[model samples]
Target: MATITVFGATGYAGGHITDEALRRGHEVIAVNRSGSAAAREGVTPVAGSIGDDALVRDLAARSDVLVVAVHGSADGQPYLAALVPNLLKAAAEGGARIGVVGGAGSLKVREGGPRLIDTAGFPEAARTESASHAKVLDALRAADTGADWFYVSPAAEFGAWVPGERTGTYRLGDNVLVTDEHGKSFISGADYAIAFVDEIDEPAHHRARFTVAY
Candidate 1:
């Protein structure tokens, strides 16, 4: 099993990813700004900010997969802009693959039109951070490092999703949003975890962004 390190292990998405990674028998090193919570049996909690280059590099050096799940605003701060690049550099130095938890705001709505964040009904508060997420995606695309990277965007209906039964079934999409026959886009947190773990097991859609939906 691959040794995986999740950068934002305390957050909702990151926590779910950590749980799923452990369930699949992968060694997980969970990193949070304030360190990790009570020790889990198989997960190692690493304490440090994503801006700590030395710590990040050390963690990356020890892992096979570096999962970037950090949440921050586009406030013109160094942390916001430097997070992805720092992780990429560390991953390259460590010879590991990178997996980014991307934002749905950047996902294409039409073939060549604006993204969902540009459309009406998008929350103003979320737009600020969503833009940061977009920048992370752009940076990953432009990165010339030979290290493999994958961007995974959750359905537009993400956040506070109730856990559904893990039927081990979900649809995957590329760039475009994934909606069900009812014309609704949603995926339970549990199912999203399943998809992320599956991707970890079988490396598909490398160096590209993909989404999951029920």
Candidate 2:
């Protein structure tokens, strides 16, 4: 029954997380530029920018967990790279753990293997965002704040184009990529939401990165 604050509540991952959390009877603060109402009921909406350190600190201080699914690379903003430091500051001030939504580009296919983004077949449309997200993860790993934070990377076949059904099952992985017998990795949005909230309740993989896939 933790109070969770989602920084990009209108987006795909954040919206799904908000839905799953509310379904589980947790308090949700959905933050977005518009502060728009969540499509579902039982959500408290907050309209603001993550760059506001004071506001973010106040929110983080009040909540038990802060879910960061905000990224602006595609729109040419790169806000996540700039927001990580302030988020670290806010989390440190408020004692809230951060649950970061990560990109698959950072996941290693094998020990000492090249990252997915560095691989030849990566999409050009994803290259900028992937690099930006990688930078955010790097900052989170190197930050001196000592705040509890963890990154959650999705699978290779994740995204709207790959909409999958709720299998009610998923596999968790470390920094390495998780794949099926056919080497295909995927997870539905609803299932990913379940996995994300599960971490908030269980608090496993603290201060580290863990991923999910089918």
lDDT of each: 0.82, 0.87
Q: Where does candidate 2 stray beyond 4 Å?
A: 39-41, 72-74
RMSD of each: 1.9, 1.4
TM-scores for all candidates: the values are 0.92, 0.95
Per-residue C-alpha lDDT of model 1 across residues 86-189, encoded as one tens digit per residue: 77888889988888877889987767877989999888878878888888888888878777899889888877645555677889998888888887888777
Question: What is the alpha-carbon lDDT of model 1 when measured against the actual structure?
Answer: 0.82
> By summed lDDT, which 10 consecutive residues of candidate 2 come out lowest?
70-79
Candidate 1 clashing pairs?
none
Please, what are the lDDT tens digits per residue for candidate 2 over residues 33-80?
898955456688999978788779999989999998877474764658
lDDT of 2 at 173: 92
Candidate 2: the clashing residue pairs are none
Worst 10 residues of 1 by lDDT: 73-82
How many clashes does each candidate structure show, in the order listed?
0, 0
Give me the displacement of residue 88 in model 2, in angstroms: 1.1
